[model samples]
Target: MEPIYKISTKKIRLLLAAVVIPCLIISITRLYYCDKVEYVRPLALEGEMQLRNDRFGDGHYAARRAGGKRHAGVDILADLDTPVIAIRGGRARALIDEDGFGNYIIITHWDETKSLYGHLSRVLLPPLGFVRQGDVIGEVGKTGNANYKSMKAHMHFEIRRKGKTIDPTFIMEAENIKK
Candidate 1:
């Protein structure tokens, strides 16, 4: 007698198709979710927060005045000489040692959001270049027009979307804020 054929060709085909189809579907779903959800962390680690003020002490706060005056940026005050990291995976769109921002590093993120780290003591090499998420962008210092008296040596962080300034607090979801 001929050796009996154990499994049918149709069953084998079905088994292979079932396993392959689910994997393909899962991969597509994962990609979609990953693209949609962009996570960013605070530029600075846990530290002391200082009072917010305009560089010139003009009574108007940096964030509030920026909105109406078309300035668009937020200022977070952390310790001086603190390390500033990239919030998300993105390219260094621009690095400017301007009058007000000091040694500033601007990162253009995946979601078209730009995160600004200012008042840096020293910026890393390849100044205007690409960097991975969590890369050290610069060291926090009272550069630019930072009011060291009131703000101290702190990282002035800002987030801009569509070339307009929005509240950085809205985007930051880090639960590391100290009391």
Candidate 2:
């Protein structure tokens, strides 16, 4: 009797190498892309976020302030009314504190990590709304403490997990990085 399902040893080897190996590699690569800890940048489409390393209240995270205080967010200097986008999709709340942040929007991302865009000139969303990734949440401006004469018009961007501030750079990166 002839074998009902005929297969060759060479064909099996080729299938494993040509198809299975590539699939496995692709799955691993996708894991990095889908990682919740590291996600998309806030201002990817508008332009790059300028993070300066300086002592004089710059955009860098954990920047030192007077009286042993540390900055909780990165201050991204930009033209007044420059568009700011949501890094990931989630529910949003637009608020005005009238002090430090002034006009700000908080988006609780799908991963439950909240992103705050503060010192905004204008907020487009309602008090409670939903936004998609890359949606225009507001425009950068000098509000609250940012309205001081010495401070430039910019977006005070921050990321928080479980009420604690985290560096946005861990996930978000400048799109126009030279390197």
Candidate 3:
């Protein structure tokens, strides 16, 4: 007779669980913390502009406003009248002239993401207009909070998902801006 060996079903399940549990934890951790690589630069003005601030997070810049309010976007330092282009294809949702944002344009992209172009010298599109990626939307200006004579001219750019502000840098790396 040949010798025979058998392992219990419970033992096999326990062995598999031990291996699978750690893998599940690792995958979840990486998905939550890893940098996303699917985004494109907002514009081709890398050389002409500089990053003034970044999104709110560890080792990132804090965006704050008057009265100790938290800021919800990134600021790109650029010259006045510098053309502002659409980061991605989207519909022009709002073109408003207000005291806070001055002249601003809100675009709702196909992915349900929204981009806000604030402190604009001029808005090129009317409300509800559709724009293609890289199309000119407006010019940089020192409107709204940036209107003070002492402030430098720049564009207040922001990216949002479902009405919540997210770091624009994540969508378009500041260092990789096109020349």
Per-candidate local distance difference test: 0.61, 0.72, 0.66
Q: Name the regions of candidate 1 deviating beyond 4 angstroms.
A: 1-37, 47-71, 125-128, 147-151, 174-179
Query: To one decimal, what is the Cα RMSD in angstroms of model 2 from the true structure?
Result: 9.0
Residue 116 CA error for candidate 3 (Å)?
Answer: 0.4
Model 3: colliding residue pairs: 63-71
Question: What C-alpha RMSD separates each model from the true structure?
Answer: 9.2, 9.0, 11.9
Q: Estimate the overall C-alpha local distance difference test score of candidate 3.
A: 0.66
Candidate 3 residue 150 Cα shift, in angstroms, is 1.2
Q: State model 1's lDDT.
A: 0.61
Best by lDDT: 2
Q: Give lDDT tens digits, candidate 3, residues 1-179.
A: 85497778999997888677632222321211111223345544654446664232121235555568676776777778888887766567545566677888887765667889888898887444867666688988878866777677777778788878877765555554433
Better of 1 and 2 by TM-score: 2
TM-score of each: 0.61, 0.68, 0.65
Task: Rank candidates, lDDT, best first.
Answer: 2, 3, 1
